[model samples]
Target: MKNSNTSDNKDMEMKYVMVIETSDYLHRLEANQLNLFTQKLHNGISKLLKKFDSQILKQDDNTYIVLFDSVTNAILCALKVKSNFKYITLKFDKSIRHLKIGIAHHTNRIAAQTLSTRMCEVVKNQIVITSEVKKAYEKENRNTFINKEHIRTLNFSEEQFLTNLMNCVETIWNNSDFSIVDFSKPLKYSKSQVYRKMISLTGKPPSSFIRDFRLNRAMHLMYDRKGNITEIAQQTGFKNPSYFSKCFKDKFGVTPKTYSKQHAN
Candidate 1:
């Protein structure tokens, strides 16, 4: 939030994390079991965090949020355990619901936009925790398990900078192909603008961020044995393997084949 040029490698400490109920559906579980369910979530999250190198802070309650040092590690955790959550009804004595999680580690304005934006799901209203909540918790010095004042606050100007920057990152991340021209056109900004925004939000330029995101997805798919390179390339928005390979090598310093071989083996 200060934008004070903090160390890029600065470790993630205990930061405020809040979970909001995003769905309109009732929790349905009995009061006694609700406590147990939250415990599962708390413990499940703790166990998941151990798989990554980052740190996590959880409290005695059913809710928990962690500050992760690496976005990559965070993403992996989010993806890996998202499907493992099961909510049960005490009366029914069966699992009846699940959860969708929203997470943010910084208190910049960009973090606010991420929470306020409506999710893509057409029918359901989305619920999210905002960066303002982080500020509020910090002001009260009551972040629970999260360390007090772990994150710095930002002013209006700094907030706007973060918001614009995160928008660019999301734009590139959502786009299937790393088509710089098309995505940049939406902002009516120059390629440099998009590039700078990407750097500010994700510590990388547009092409680089998109490449890494795609590669991460590709790895998951390859691990699942879901598709071959040609198919995966197309699915990820690369028109052909040659173009994908070139971009991949430029980022990873190796051809996809070699990279996959090294990682897979």
Candidate 2:
């Protein structure tokens, strides 16, 4: 098993996208029907690519992996597979199991099997071909996706601790109940101690770290409903709408209402 970046051809290897099983595919189909559907699925995927510069492997009965030459090719493959969710037909059956796709560029060093399982789990969580996945698939933004925000804390470089922190943060990501105190509660360190550790390691206060998270949430909610400024502020955990407005101005250099108006136009 080859890892993501370990494919040797760095210039050619953009990413490996895993097409995961998203439904109860075995619920109704007989073994022969299942085989037929799988064949159709494979042929459908191969047909999407204009130039077959990469390998498409049948990892299992249901899962497929496509190694594409570039991020554009990967995104094209992902969108193609997702679009087929509404179009694919079997020979004897009118419908088949739907699929969800997950894509990650070849940058990290993880085992191939582990990467496959993790990608499958991720694709299952994301039913759609998500905007994050789509944005990461862009040529100019591809580096930003895998590189820009990934700051590994050097002093407290414990994998389990980082994993736990990520899990806790992601679990309550959109919840207003998530705070620095809540994030520190399960870390086996006192609140102040955890604050100091994060500052020493990551060069910022824990509250400062999540400030961007909340601000980004606010921006996302703005796009969701173009005119609901106060409601978006409260939803992002800003108790004072005025203060939230100020923060938004400071970050994006535009007031929430003005930004909303611009987007609305």
Candidate 3:
């Protein structure tokens, strides 16, 4: 290894690096769906980064590595991206519901690379920063780091619970037979416990959550022009096309056929 003093000196250089990636569920989507989701995500992130004077150094599928000359801009960009995530994914058929961000302040490209690699472990919908970044941000701004609305970090148990819950939903969401019992089995939580926890966290009970998830997927499929109404309904786990059309109308204010025609390419 190189001398410790040399590494320290290199780290003293002024550069900020930010890494962003969507939830693990993105990898579970079909290729077409994945492309559509990432494209939308990238567009939204690019628009936000423009306000911060940052450059995207690299991007691989859903993961983006961004570089900034100013720590304040990097931190502000992270906060902005996190705040706008839901809006960014609003048009997606199956949304990328969360983003995990890691920000670091370093002197050189090598040190920035190392810092970004370690930040990959950050939890979903969370923003994590190095001590250097935290210090630099406070020095540049009058506000304390803890006072920021976007600085919230989930505890390990809460992170794990959300991860498991989301993974479970993604895995079984396309099954027409999927029910509250099926939803609870993978989580190992009883129906009532899962019900309360989901409501507390998402403000929607399990059944409504699953239904909304399905309806969202169906809407995306229509946008993609993936198939006719019947096939889209079946693919998204609705028991019948009529029921799917009714739900679609209830959620979207128009029937599926009308949506398909209006959005057709």
Candidate 4:
């Protein structure tokens, strides 16, 4: 146990690991083969991180934004191509071992050393966030999937995964207030099927996806309108301010109050 802990610590120190999985992609594949592609990607990342004895953090669904940082490993992970917008099945695989992450936090240096593993790279040549993630998801219009973001660059396999997962992200994004009973009735799929689909696409259950989506949407709402945190919470489907605050901090790395202070103009 001591050796295992030591090894884990070493992995955490030297390497930066990030894993994002989607269930909608899994839905498109056979039941027995859910997340195999993502598993391979995760395996590759784990292996790479192990070489550096890096620490790993896995975030499910469309929550990759939370893993952004300026370290070389973080920057390399951010550049990983998981899917494409136009093509749903072409996988573009690249080794991020040599990628150098550059951040503006320090003009004297190229990246942020203080944030060790929390930041991802800032690539001038890359457009990481796109409307395509939203559009591809809207096209599906299901209860279990939701559109999150579209990959600017992807190969065939990656495209396939994005097409399916983006749809799942959209499904969840549009129906943040939908109840489990409603989902079970309309889809006519078993509860397990519903759970598995969400798990495969978002690396989280359906409920967590909805909650995070609501929080993200609430953040947008709070940013755009004149309202208090309580109002934003209710508007985003939270019945209680306390729970909403907890979820907000868990997802965004800060309380709603802090987020408002940081972003409010």
* TM-score of every candidate: 0.41, 0.42, 0.56, 0.38
83-151 per-residue lDDT for model 1 (tens digits): 445433233322335344444545442442244331111102122233454444445554442222222
**lDDT per residue, candidate 2, 1-265, as tens digits?**
7677664555345455444453334323444665676677667666765354556645555566655556666655555566775565533333334455555444442333234333343222332232334455544464544322221111123324444555665566556556677877888778887777666533557676566557766776775573488888777777789988998887665788776765552
Q: Tens digit of lDDT per residue, candidate 4, span 33-102?
A: 4345545544554454454333433334222212222233333344443322212234522321112221
Would you list the clashing residue pairs of candidate 2? none
Q: How many clashes in each structure? A: 0, 0, 2, 42
Clashing residue pairs, backbone N/CA/C < 3 A, model 1: none
Cα error of candidate 1 at position 95, Å: 40
**Candidate 2 segments whose C-alpha is farther than 4 A from its true place:** 1-159, 171-179, 200-202
On the 0 to 100 scale, the lDDT of residue 157 in model 3 is 52
Write the candidate numbers in order of decreasing lDDT: 3, 2, 1, 4
How does residue 215 of candidate 3 score in lDDT?
Answer: 84
Residue range with the least summed lDDT across 10 consecutive positions in model 2 = 147-156
Q: Can you write out model 3's per-residue Cα lDDT over 1-265, one digit (the tens) per residue?
A: 7786984454344388888876344643456776787787778888888889877777876678887878888888887887787676666554435577877665676666554533443232277666677777788886656444566333445445665777687789889988899878899989999888777555688787788778877876776688899999999999889999998887776788777766564
True lDDT of residue 113, candidate 4: 32
Distance from true position, residue 207, model 4, in Å? 1.2
- Strongest candidate by lDDT: 3
Instruction: At residue 188, give the lDDT of candidate 2.
Output: 74
